[model samples]
Target: MVAGKPFERWRVAGTRRRGLTVRLIGGIIPIVTLSARQNAGRLRQRQEWQFFATTFRARPGLAGLWWGIVVLRGVLPAGFAVAMGVLIGAIDDGAPLVAPLALTGVIFLGMQVLGPIHMALSRNMGDQTAAWLYDRLTDYCLEPAGLGHLENPGLAADQAAARDFDLGQSAPPLRLSMGFIADGIVSFVSGVACALVLFGYVWWAPPILAGCWLATHWLLRESGIWRDRNTDEVRRAQQDAEYHYRLAVDPAPAKEIRLFGLADWVLNRFVLRRRRLHELQFEATRLRERSVLLSLAVVLTGNLAVFGAIGRDLVGGGLALGAAVTFTQAAIGAVAIAFGGLNWSLDSAAAPVAAVLRLREPMATAGALPAPSGPSCPSGPTGSSGRPGSAGPLTAQTGSGAGELRLRGVTFGYPGTGTTVLRSLDLTVPAGSSVAIVGRNGAGKTTLAKLICRLYDPDEGSIEFDGVDIRRFEVEAWRAHISAVFQDYIRFEWPLRDNVAPTGAPDDMVLAALEAAGAHGLADLDTVLAKGYPGGIDLSGGQWQRVALARTLVAVRGGAGVVLLDEPTAQLDARGELEIFSRVLAETRGRTTVLISHRFSTVRMADLICVVEDGAVVEAGSHDQLMRANGRYRTMFDLQAQRFDEPQEVGGDVLA
Candidate 1:
């Protein structure tokens, strides 16, 4: 759980042993078509090449090592067969047993020792490569560029597949591909040697082996298709299992489920999904059992034919017992190894290819967006020639003082929503000013604050810093001069110092800001803040709000020119709200401030008040001006001010 360790690394390592165990268990079980037909597609040649190049590039050393091991492994088995055959021929022909027996035992022992070493090394290397690939894919998915692409459901599903796919199968594919090439070479050499030896007796033995191999190859190709189809079904089942688990465990729905006594209903839904998975698995199992039985039948029949032919030769004194025994053992071992290598290669290639394709989809889409050029001022009145006024000094002068902020003709919408949240809103504040935005729910007050902070860009119009267009500057650079406490502000699981610091580290400036914001005594700055863990503490809503305010003050002290407070006192009592605001006003003199609130008392203190309704600025003026005019602002102010005496609920009407 340490930062920057990458989630994929932990998942990959944790699941690797389990995946291999599953494969081994499945290997022993009867062959079933566990793959789904939906997964099969015409392989793209370009993609194939890209997959090869990328895998090789990522693990060039491992690739070379694996290839060498495969070649050695393949050659050793054939060499052992030839040595055994020579030793048997000599013994049968009345040669001394000591020399031949010693040489034959040494060769067999060497092959046995080397086989395990090769398997161990290849497995270890494959695991390392899979881990590295998983990390790379995770990084690609998490990059800022991929954010927009994640909105696509298809892309999200593909990513989910990649993450959920078993990476333990990764090593098998790599090992099998190399193993196949090596086995093919060894098989060719052994076939030629056997043909030369058997031709003296009968030219038909080599041809029969070749025919059996061709027939098995065809069967294996068909089996590969079935396997891929079954894999898809299993993947779907896994997805369903995860969905059921989430529904059962998620916090948001727990209360509703408990209230309605729907525990059995949720459990039944989970059971139904799992039952479907079990049924699909049963079908796959049946199919695999049949396939294995058929394969074994073919293998046994082929061996019988060879044995029958050799028996005739022995009866005629054409071949010795030891020679026939050694040939049969070596040939059968080679055939079994070849089939295993091919099956592994064909079945294991899909997941890594799918992962790479999924990653590329997001990366390509992100790359196509138009790059934001150099900082260009966002279009606004401040940048226009009509407003040639210098609002105020750029930095803090001496004593605390309020600053000014002006917004002109701003319009904005959430991305892809096709509905404007704020439209043609204009407001202004003079130096040493504090303004509150007040309106009913969906009044666009929160939207206005976000636009000011540039968390998003305006669809039309602009926001200004002093007399300059804020958009013209680098986005981060402009944000550095603004401090905002959002309604949905996140509370990070870190020490209090980080929660209040200008950035992540503690500084003298952070301490000054925390004191000024009236939040310094909540807890020791060194105290770690996290929930549901040893030594972790949870803060109440009010205390968290205070900490949020402290975060903004830290930003302000670090040279933020503007401060946006969105419902800063929503969690506080009336007295606490007044005290916090009063301290903020006193300590943040000379700094421009925009406050968005439902409380009339909080808004009335502002030098300018703006009333937003239905995404437009319906009224704007000083608090006194608006109240005297008896406009939209006046009606809302009066309605809220009356709440204190009426003993009515606060925020009820405004929120409604």
Candidate 2:
């Protein structure tokens, strides 16, 4: 028995030590995990703050004023509560009503005065932030060295998602961010003050209330995350909805919609897409409802326990009656203020704030390539990983400015499609010559032009300038070597001078270009191109074409090595086409030019005529040589010629 007693004592000592070690490690593990998570959270939060800070620093005075107001807001709420408590105590002691009433009046008046000032500050902040963000977005989109991102499906979808939400809403992310941060600060400060007041009554009360609030906060945060988790789905649905809605109402499609009687069909499609979006939103609402209900239940249970304890203390003389009344009001007021601030500030801001973060993260690393003028271009163009003898530098060609271009085994496909638009197409255009590309629609003629302008690179093979792989040169610098006018050219709605500004050309040079393009009759330097502006007038399609051609001529005048004209005279009258073509022939003499057209008049004049069919050059020769060969070009030319020669009947009269 004596030996067993010592054994029991030894066993107890070892077990206690083991238990102590296990408990210590278990306790420490959570602390360590929590610390790491907190650090990560802080780091992420710091980055978000830094993004806003970068923007806010541009207008430092506004930031300072806004922050001052936010800090004052924090102090005011706690001050008001404290003053109320003191006033209540004074009233209980039969103190003067004047002091309490004066104090309360000042607090109420300040809050009321803050309303307009806060609104003014918020409005100013929103406008400034929107302008800055729009500039940033524009730069980000336009400055990419390549057109790949613009063509990328996933990136486009993400953009549609982020951009679709911002339409017509005054509450931008940055604007809401300001209010959210301010309200959060106010809530924290007020909570602390309230906690301190409650601490005097019972040390344990503050901890219980904090725990309950934290639990509620966690649920709210999770619910928000749940809503954001499916943004891609939401974005896609929105795009579909917009597409259908446009089909129903857009002026461009109005004629087709009415003739086809597609109003109901389009509206139905819009409803379906919007319904899909609403379903996802409905799911989010349910999650929010669940979280809210649970939070309310938790609050009710915790507050009941707390109030009951306080009541017991009051009845037992542990707390004075007046102090009890003050405590009760302060406690309830603190909870209400904190909850109100959080609910109003955080909920509306969540989606927008998250979108900002998501957008910044993706775009930060996107389009890493940039175009800059320099000599950092790869020297060995022949060694650029492609088929041998494909292409090399400009010096490798017969002569400089001889209009030499080589497409060696080039292949490409548009995004989201496996079908190749250009397949292993090899062709060479000699310097000081013109090549006309004739092809059916979808024959990759426009795609070839995009490649030469460095808008898109070939998936396989090489497009060489002179003899060098074009990709080796900086995109913008290389693009400066080419002038192009596309078929569907844009008519910018800016002043004529502004549209053509930054060209570094003198007025005489610009006027010469305008004359060359037959667009000299359009309004002058200060004239706006749209109808809403005073003295503004919209141009016809042909006039717009002339303006677009003038823009191209400016590029050519600035010494572009090559010129690309894609149906440049498509919208012009027969005489107008002849005039523009005459100018093109004269100006582009002694330089390389690639013209894409369906008309026989221009194609027959090319030094070399190539027929692009099924993404390959199927026929090539000079006009006379192709006629002799009696191939694809000859057949197409004969067919077009026959059309003009055929007789036509107009109102029962033959017009031959």
Question: Highest TM-score, which number?
Answer: 2
TM-scores of all predicted structures:
0.66, 0.79
Q: Using alpha carbons, what is the TM-score of model 1? A: 0.66
**Residue lDDT tens for model 2, 208-302:** 77667666767776443335323677667766776787687667699888899988888888898877766765455444778888888887787
Least accurate 10 contiguous residues by lDDT in model 1: 383-392
As a whole number from 0 to 100, the lDDT of residue 350 in candidate 2 is 41
Off by over 4 Å in 1: 1-59, 74-79, 94-127, 134-138, 141-154, 162-307, 334-353, 360-471, 502-507, 531-534, 566-575, 585-587, 594-656
Clashing pairs in 2: 392-467, 392-468, 393-467, 393-468, 402-431, 402-432, 403-431
Please name the candidate that would achieve the greatest lDDT relative to the true structure. 2
